[model samples]
Target: MNSLKLPDIAAQKLLHVTPLDWVGMCAIALPIQLEGRHVAAMADAGVNLVDGKSRGIHMSRLYLALEQLEHQALTPLAIHQLLADFLASHEGLSTAAHLRLSFEHLLKRPALVSPLAGWKSYQVSVDARLENEMFHVELSVRVPYSSTCPCSAALARQLIQRQFEADFSGEVLNRESVLAWLGSSQGIVATPHSQRSQASVQLRLRNNLDTVPVTELIDAVEASLGTAVQTAVKRADEQAFALANGQNLMFCEDAARRIHQALRELDIATAFTLRVEHAESLHAHDAVASSQWQW
Candidate 1:
């Protein structure tokens, strides 16, 4: 009888292994700092199979690499290098690498009147791919705004005018009094529908650059809509918000076009996909419109 010693898997170098079509980890939870703010990010990483003949990848190595890069700010350049490092670590096992990172981006916005508003959270995702030694990056963001019904505003005005003429049939028509009445509660009795809406934007960067300020895009969208929905409110802020809703009354089509025009004016027209979803208050289902430019 003879005793045999087994080789250590952790210390021994992996050899003669076939390439994998895909290998790596997914849903890896880690803390990441974006724009000098620390946030939690769920990252997914994988690489294309090498030769279709391999047992499995060193999953622990993938985890460690991600942990090492977790605190580093994720810019376009950093992402490219990270992907390259991930592939190189597994050597011969994969050629192309893919990584997806999703997190909640907190944005601090000022109220229409109130001071020192808290931060608002937006859902954001970043996707990157490395193929043939070229890197590609895409950033996506979800923003919430307010949409008012245009038809409702117009119809209310018409009804108020008719009621005014009927109520003052026997009295002498004084322009000043009539105008005051019209501006009063009785003059504009219209049912206005307000919907909480969301806009999702995805931008593909040229030369694998991901430094495009996502917050700026979100701000532009909120500005284009004229107002963002408020989470916390006071009396003054509420009144200001009401004024905004009344002034910026829009249809679903108007919302979509506004966003499209905003993106176009920014000169990043050819590098993005835009999706606007209005969760309607007047209807049970949502109204959605999407468009993209070719580049």
Candidate 2:
């Protein structure tokens, strides 16, 4: 039996038709392949509704074109092709297309001093836009690390010295005594406050790359910060992490500069912006710093 004709509200023309800058679906749940594994992702697919005369854009067509991305590996070529498909599907209705996918990129990471390894999740975003036949791509990642305040370290050292003087008052300092005291809790009384921090980086990838350099970018940010938060850790690994934090003391400004310098050396990035947030334990408010280059 033929289905009864239904009213089509989407196709109904308005009395005053006006153009929309952007119109489409957002936060759509979809499974996408990244690298060789399947990862669940959310996509924001849309196009510029430039056809004012038309009642509205064919939203289902835009969605169908985006559905093709479900089976394809997420890459620069795939993203560019998907955007082209978006425009092609819109035909005369759209002059620009944009797609954004957000997902967690997981990688296996080895402990600093242990044989154990564990999976690490990185918040990743792949954004692409095609306007006037010009294509562009951007990659963003969030990395967590440890930040030790330099000022706190200095204050802690001062307190430790005073404690040591009180413990060994009017006594000649001896090597064995000092060593014993250093090994004991009394010898190392004060500790600098260190807190968890994160660096959020966005890079305008050069069009010459075959795929996103997610590992390289994460490595650079970790290297710059120097005390990346760990997954699996033995006692030795914990000690090593503590030592790293002590050696890599930094303020928020310092963290920002380090990340900025590291990203500047990478050739994959045509331009970049970075933000470092030190979730300060000493204060209720967090300390933050940001830097950008090449716009």
Candidate 3:
């Protein structure tokens, strides 16, 4: 019997073909270890086929190279190594390499004024590109919060004031009776409408950092917003949350500015872009605001 030879279409050079800007694969399903937990992650791996004479790249090499993610933490150094492997596998055919890994990061969050806690998930993405020996990494995270409209709150207070005056048109107001009425439903007729909102932040980080600062970024976002959505709550916790929301009432634009200033004051992120979305209860569409800072 004769030995069989496998066909290598990827190695065959085709003349006069235009080189592709990006080549390889996307949405490849894989399971990876993130900070010790096994997380299912989708990977998009690719390299630029810079050599016009090369017909194609070894796509399997890119796929196999992603296995490194499953074994190690997704850090800047790890990503750099992965990108290097991507180009090394393609050798003379590639000049630049890129990788995007997206996954949900889950954390246990305690409720306000409660002993209980539960898990909350945040959408996270890491985008890496190695071009011309300059490696760049960008991280994106989405955090859900509660946004209260300042205008609506003021309008509601006005309506409540008008009702109070009508109730005591000529009657002398007293601390005792006034407190009674205030405790009654007539004193609290309406409340400002609020809804769930999201803050989407993208940060461009400097190299030489060892680990991914995922938890730190999430903490910064929550602290800036001041009214992050709760996971588990008792009645007291719910009341505390309401009080926090009342104290930190903000519109979409307000949320964006808060995030921008908070991030700048921290001075951790090299460059950042923040966007806030308030899923308004008063409108059919969401209200959005964006801000960016770069040096």
Candidate 4:
């Protein structure tokens, strides 16, 4: 038997040494454990090529390290450990490691006033970094809701009032007649415009937490907005949703403020940035507002 030597090209010295900030892979598909479920996720795994003399980082090591997320529930500690593994594998070749995972989180939501329920998916991403022995993690989520324009509602109410005055100009006003008129399409000539809206938030978590409060954060945002989009609905649920929209009229700015206050009260994150986007049915352009705290 003959012993053959294998070539190690990555270990070879470079003629012009230059350290790269980041090097590895992006959009690596994998299954990850989240909230007791196996979720399909994509990851961006990389490490800083701190060793200028080295040709490149061992990218295979970074890909193999992602296996830790397969069965274990995602948490701050798990992400921290994964980043540590990246650094440990690279040793002297890398000084810092980074990981980003993107996935849709499924939640079963009950109808507003029915026993029926359906699944809703929220766009979520987890970003983590390990540098100078410090570990940092950020959690982001996009929540879809419904927003009714306050100005439009007010305008609709004015039109309805004028129509009422015109309808009963000479006739005697009575509860039955008024009720019938209110139920007729002629009575309510205009209706407020409502559109689907989205709230995107990024939170920098405090280092002391063991678990990520993803559901709790989503709940807070939905509760604050008060008009989250429904999945499955009966007529009763639809009516209730309409009532919710009627009572919770808001502009993009108002939605942003509501979310900002709610997340601040949660106190789970040291800093956060949030943006609310209203896909306005009244205008051709979208309405958007952004807010941040200690970020």
For each candidate, the alpha-carbon lDDT, in order, equals 0.79, 0.89, 0.89, 0.94
Q: How high a TM-score does candidate 4 get?
A: 0.97
Report clash pairs, candidate 1.
Answer: 19-50, 19-51, 20-49, 20-50, 21-48, 21-49, 22-49
In candidate 1, what are the lDDT values of residues 1-295, reduced to their tens digit?
6678875454344566555567677889988767777779899988776754555666776677777556677787888888888888778777888889998898777778888486799999989899888787888899888888888778876887788877787999889988898778777666677889888888776554445467777888888989688866789999999999999988777888888788777643347888888898878999888877763
Better of 1 and 4 by TM-score: 4
Model 2 CA deviation exceeding 4 Å by range: 1-9
TM-score of each: 0.86, 0.94, 0.95, 0.97
**Candidate 4: regions farther than 4 A off:** none
Best by TM-score: 4
Clashes of each: 7, 0, 0, 0
Give the RMSD in angstroms, all C-alphas superposed, for model 2: 1.8
- lDDT (0-100) at residue 259 of candidate 3? 90
lDDT of 2 by residue, 205-225 (tens): 887787678888999999988
Best by lDDT: 4
Pairwise lDDT winner, candidates 1 and 2: 2
Pitting candidate 3 against candidate 4, the one with the higher lDDT is 4
49 in model 2: Cα distance from truth in Å?
0.5
What is residue 115's positional error in candidate 4, in angstroms?
1.3
lDDT of 3: 0.89
